[model samples]
Target: MIQNTVPGATRTQAQRTAATRAKLLDAAVDSLVEQGYSGISTQGIAKRAGVSRGAQLHHFPTKESLVVAAVEHLVDKRLMEILESQPDPEYGFEALFDAFTGPLFDAALELWVAARTDPALHAAMIQLERKVSDALRTGCLEIMGDRVSPDIIDLGIELARGFAVSALMRTPESDREFRERLLPVWKALVSK
Candidate 1:
């Protein structure tokens, strides 16, 4: 006689492991975005992921490791999005600005502040920053395609990041106006 089976019973052990890891990673990132690094707790992450605390511990034994993994997960996703978009030069600045100015940036800012005081987090952040910088450079190169010098592209990205940071201090409408006003000037400068 045939036996009743679960719908996902055919999934291999590796697939199940991967699925659990993905859920944890996603939940961790959401926690980072919502609670910042200082506020996140392993139990909270596990509850958000709908996984047991043991499962969370089994996957990420330390809070630092989980936070690092979550940031890396987000960076990888953003890099993939930038690579896939293949934006034209006219829209490239907007795309780069978008990448630097969202929930990812908010979480990153929180980590950056906390990393300043935590040695282990500082080290992890250094490596992660290098990875992000390289990926962003690659994406910029692909998007600009010789239209702008590498130095110019670097400067533009920094400027965009600066604007993003400044956004926290200003009203949203003022920030929008500031970007709109300066973006044209930046484009003109780069075009020369």
Candidate 2:
């Protein structure tokens, strides 16, 4: 009789670890959004996540570590939302660009402002921003190649990010205008 030493148990262990991580991140977000950076405690997060305090601490031994992971998770979720929300391919890159930029840019800029005052959060935010920029540059270079050049794409991206930063500084009405205005710039730069 063979003992049940199947790989399934290992896979289950990995799944449980992932689920626990997600729960911790979720709890951290809720706490941070509600209480800001200073107000969150590990016990509070554990209660929010419905996990044990020891478990929460085990996953994130330091407050700084927890905050950094929370920020990164938030940024990653933002990217996934944009990537998943793409309309049918027939609608094409124009729609895809609009969907990804408008809301994401505004929120990201606001988060950047908040992060500026906190070193751990600043590092986390910077890492996410660089990831997005690198991904964009890679995609643009692959499609446009030598014809357009990386410098041109880089410049345009900076310009768009500038516009988004300005939008976050404005009132809601003006923020809407900021998003609407970017379409022309995007079309000119990327459209064939």
Candidate 3:
């Protein structure tokens, strides 16, 4: 008999399963960010994750399920990052805006666009998006504390998201200027 040793040898079956699922979900997010919605596939995700096709299917039986799960997983990870970060006394709003427009938004934008014409994907994304929005709202409240009204935070989120979307249509130079000009206005609004 041959002896077999692996790094996860001590992990329970459930732990191993969860690890594999996480790997697949992460790979799915990478695919979504890099390839857009139409470019993602079960086979590609499995290959990227270094897992078998059957394993991917075992975890998520459909493409919609896989993409939705990936979105939820990525949002949860980003929320944790936001919640655990130390707020900057001088540039908290700027930092928050940057975090909102980061890679998570890019990946989620791809899914949002795809969902417009995909009933199943749209159905799955609606709930996940709401969950993400709620989590982000709570995180923002915690970060800002009593410094700003809830309405200001809500407007700030919409403004940041709109800027992020508009950036996709133009060059980076204009986007930089736009943010530079808008930041003070946003700060003033929050200080009111």
Q: What are the lDDT scores of the predictions, listed in order? A: 0.83, 0.64, 0.82
Tens-digit per-residue lDDT, 1-192, candidate 2: 444367764445656777888999877776776676667788888888888888888889876677567756665665465446643433333333442354344344445666889777676777777876776565555444465667666765676566655554689788677666766666566556
lDDT per residue for candidate 3 within 1-192, as digits (tens), equals 433346656766776798899999999988988999898899999999999999999999999899889888877887787677766644657755775576688888988899999999999998998897687677777887877777777777777777788888867788789889989987886786
- Give the TM-score of each candidate: 0.90, 0.63, 0.89
Model 2 alpha-carbon drift over 4 Å, by segment: 1-11, 84-111, 114-126, 136-149, 189-192
Q: What are the root-mean-square deviations of the candidates from the true structure over C-alphas?
A: 3.7, 5.5, 3.9
Which numbered prediction scores highest in TM-score against the true structure? 1
Worst 10 residues of 2 by lDDT: 90-99
- Residue 10's lDDT within candidate 3 is 76
- Model 3 regions lying over 4 Å from their true place: 1-8
User: In candidate 3, which residue pairs clash?
Assistant: none
Candidate 2's displacement at residue 76, Å, is 3.6
> Native-vs-model 1 lDDT?
0.83
Cα error, candidate 2, residue 60 (Å): 1.3
Q: Please write out the lDDT profile of model 1 over residues 1-192, one tens digit for every residue.
A: 443357856766676778888998888888988988899998999999999999899999977788788778888899898888677767877777887877778878888888999999898889888887777777888887888778887887788888888889999999999889988888888787
- 68 Cα displacement, candidate 3 (Å): 1.6
